[model samples]
Target: MNKTINQKAWFFVVPVFVLVAFNAVIPLMTVVNYSFQETFGNNVFMWEGTRWFKQILQSERFHAALGRQFLFTGIILVIQIPLGIAIALSMPKEGPWVSVCLVLMSMPLLIPWNVVGAMWNIFALPEIGFLGHTLNGLGFDYNFTQQIGDAWFTTILMDVWHWTSLVVLLSYAGLMSIQPAYYQAAEIDGASRWSVFRYIELPKMKKVLTIAILLRFMDSFMIYTEPFVLTGGGPGNATAFLSIDLVKMALGQFDLGPAAAMSLIYFFIVLLVCWVFYNLMMKNEEQS
Candidate 1:
């Protein structure tokens, strides 16, 4: 006799669905509505299908922001993934120190994004701040507020400090899940450290690393708050990623139509790129 599944479980899910609809679906519909129309004061709206989309697609500012966004994501992935993996590899698989190491690695991830930015902003000041004063004393003119390069460096460093812990934690989790039997087998085969990592550890860690990379990419690409707080999208828009640019368009310029259109397009671009990365990762997993 087959057991009947509970139909009442749908009732349990309904509240979550309604919440999602209220929070996500409603705002999304509002954006779509704004995207296809032009508006003036007094609630006047004119139908302008795809006009905003086309305008945004052709805008140099949007393209520049997109390019910068990609570059930031790329740089972060390059640094964080390798560094996290190295750290994970070095971390004790099991010992009294394991908890200590894990907690230390995770400490940075606990800070709120805006507060991290504020902390860094103060820390990196070129005069009164310790970092800035030390750099200045060392004969380095470090002024993030004025120099575009300095601003970019500060933003990148802040992001790395804030988010690298995520990669490390994920990588560590993956490392922990790996069975001791594999290491034992590798030892029986007299495998070197490189060989063990290459043939066993790396393959085992692939799934988690993919997750880490994807998460880092998406977070870095969509990053707004920390950089905005630190640089305010200055020194002259040098650190203006796509999210910052979109905010400027939507709120600063009050161009709701184009902002909405750009938001949809940006959403899709993120989705598409993430899909490609996911597929590539799966293919690698299959191959290994």
Candidate 2:
């Protein structure tokens, strides 16, 4: 006899569906509506088709912002992934210190993003800031506010400080999930640390690492508040990522149509990249 499925669970899911519709779907639909329409003022809208999309796509400013966004994400991924793995590996597997280490690692992640930016901004100022004063005292011109290179450096450093902990935590969790049998076998085979990690730990951690990478990629790509607080897209648009540009267009310039179009494009690019990453990761897992 076939077992009957419980239909009562459907009621529980309805609330979640409604919540998602209100939070994500509704906002997305609004953006989509704005993207394809033009408004002069006072809630008046006229169908503009794909005019805004084409304009945003063709604009050199959008292109530059997109390039910078990609570059920033790439740099963070490169720095954080390896650094996190190394830190996780070095931590104690079983000890009183494990709790201490974990808490320390989590401290940065607990701070508000805007606060992190503001703190870093103050900490890196050329005159009164500790970092800036020390660097300048050492005869180096370290002014993030006025210098493009210094601004990029400070932003990257701040992100690494704030987010690398997340990678470390994920990597540690992945490491913790490994069965003792695997280590036993590796030890019995006289396997080196590199060999053990390469053959065992790394493969096991792939799933979590994929998650870590995706989270970091999305966060870094969509980053706004911190960079906005710190740089204000200053030194002449040097640090202005897509999100900042979109905000500037929508609010600063009051160009809602183009901004909405750009936001939709931005949303899709993130979605597409994430889809590709998930596919590639799953494919690798299947092959392995």
Candidate 3:
């Protein structure tokens, strides 16, 4: 017997394919095109080959920005992951308070990114803002605008405030999915709280924790807007992570070739890290 395949479902996918091509593929191709050539006005271009890429890879500024980006992402991950899990553990799992807790947690994630940046910008001014004023009143010497330490602190604090909720939500969902039988078993065995968490909750949460780590890594690695608005990459480029630096090169300095090269590098870095995370998570799943 010969089978004829029905291809009608592809019609539904055609629109989505075309939309992605127009929005993602086409612009990506343009960036690749610009990455190889130098332009000097009136559509004039020179085929510079790998010159831009070499410059970007060798630049000290790029290195500095990359290091800062890694540092920021690392710090936030260390803080947010455990903190989110702790808060989720503390939260009422099944009560009227659950709804109130969830809503409160969601509020930060609902705020627009740019608005969060702008809000934090004023909120950290060290003059009129409540946080700034309170800190200064307590003799903390906090001034984000002109102080590198303060700027970094403020930016990190703002990020933790805005994003910890996401991790909390994910973790709480993971915890709730776990069967109560595990807890009952632990109770019967006279398991300590830490023992329950270690042998049962943590193991069960591994998958979601992996997902949470990946999401947070991607977001923090590509973070740009909030720190930009708050510190403006100031205090001698202290908070100028890779994204901020790339914008400065592309728009601020109008160095298209180098900027494109740097952007492609940035893209590859993010892609590579995500790929590694995926592989590690998959390997762990296989082993378990």
Cα lDDT of all candidates, in order? 0.90, 0.95, 0.93
Q: For candidate 2, what is the total of clashing residue pairs?
A: 0
TM-score leader: 3
* Candidate 3: segments with Cα more than 4 A from true spot: 1-4, 284-288
Return the TM-score for candidate 1, rounded to 2 decimals. 0.94
The digit string of per-residue lDDT tens for model 2 on 11-60 reads 99999999999999999999999999998779999999999999999999
RMSD of 1: 1.8
lDDT (10s digit) by residue, model 3, range 129-236: 989999999999999999888998999999999999999999999999999999999999999999999999998888889999999999999998898888889888
TM-score of candidate 2 against the unseen true structure = 0.93
- Model 1 misplaced regions, further than 4 Å: 277-288
Could you tell me every candidate's TM-score relative to the true structure? 0.94, 0.93, 0.96
Q: Arrange candidates by TM-score, descending.
A: 3, 1, 2
Lowest lDDT block of 10, candidate 3: 37-46
